[model samples]
Target: MPPQQALAIARAFLPKRPWGNRYDYYYTRAKLRTDPLYPGVLAALRDTPGPVLDLGCGLGLLAHALHVDGQPRAYYGVDIDASKIERARQIARRTGLKDARFEVVDLGARWPEHTGNVAILDMLQYLPSQVQAGMLAHVSRMLAPGNKLVIRSALGDDSGRGRTSKVTDLMAHFAGWMQEVPKSYPTRESLEGHLANAGLSATFSPLYGNTPFNNWLIVAERRAG
Candidate 1:
């Protein structure tokens, strides 16, 4: 999405009161302009069918992006932050986005019952390795043949970009954007192994566009038996 287009979307997030709305507006603008996460996820989900269950969806940006891009898929976004969820709901309602919903749910504790494509973006590192593994397994089960499970995360490594991602996440925690400090970052090998164990194949690609983070987009698919 271009900066001018992103500016238009950020307008939807602007709150009624100017007190805290500026933060959301600027954050959404910066994220949409600088991060390539939304476009990448949209491309991965383009040909897929059925509703989308977006785990760890913050402020439901993906839903908004999907609506803007004319995907027309039902978007159910869940996150642990109630405030963010509420704001997402309000935006969706105000924008008259059809079939878009948001809910506050602790992803580490439970997942909503869903059967379709799944997306876990930029939130896996906050969960422990075991929790992340379990979540992957559950997502794998939910995915029907030919459906996708898309994930965007910073793969763990010793490179400068990897270190930068770690530090950035920590700063987000300290800055109150994230309530939990990142516990573990998954490596490419580990994520591939987990998907394979669940009878899925994954393709990983760099998603860092004009950014210094080590983010990668992993698109996993369940083949027909």
Candidate 2:
């Protein structure tokens, strides 16, 4: 689906009042406009099978986007924020998403029981390095042969974009948007190694949106032994 059309459908799912909840509405709209990751995510899931597991799914934006794009697959979104999960549920009801489910679960506690293509976007960096590695390992185990795992993160690079991303992340931290900002961001090498050790071959590509950030996506597919 075209980005504008998809975004229109997405906005339809937002709160009805134009002035009351302006922040959420405008934030969602702006994200759809500026963030190219949303479109990339849709493209990645186009051919993948159903029952998508979305980790760190804030306000269930991806779930709503998929529904708007006419993907009728069953979606399960897990996030640590209770309020976000509640809003996600409300959106699902308001939009009549019968196949979608949202829940508040601490990712560090354990992996939710699921089997399908996985999407971890813009959330892994909040975890410590060890936790990140452990989650990746668990995802590797949960992924059956031939399934895909799509991960988007700001890799630690020395380039201008990388530095910009770091500063923005710090601002996010100070704003209380992100609670657990790690001391270090994952480098491309370390991220690739983690995936490789999990027996998943990953290809990297830059995901530059209208914003200046060093966002990159890793599309990893599990190979049959």
- Which predicted model would earn the best TM-score? 1
- Runs of candidate 1 with Cα error greater than 4 angstroms are 18-20
* TM-score of each candidate structure, all chains considered together: 0.96, 0.92
| lDDT by residue for model 1 (100-177), tens | 988899878987888999999999997888888888888888897678999999999999999999999999999998
Candidate 1: residue 197 lDDT (0-100): 78
Q: Residue 1 deviation, candidate 1, in Å?
A: 1.0
**Residue 188 local lDDT, model 2:** 92
CA displacement after TM-score superposition, residue 146 of candidate 1 (Å): 2.3
- Report per-prediction Cα RMSD to one decimal: 1.2, 1.9
lDDT of each: 0.89, 0.81
Error at 36, model 2, angstroms: 0.7
Clashing pairs in 2: none
lDDT of 2: 0.81
Residue by residue across 100-166, what tens digits does model 2's lDDT show?
8998888877778888889998888777777788888888876766668989899988999989988
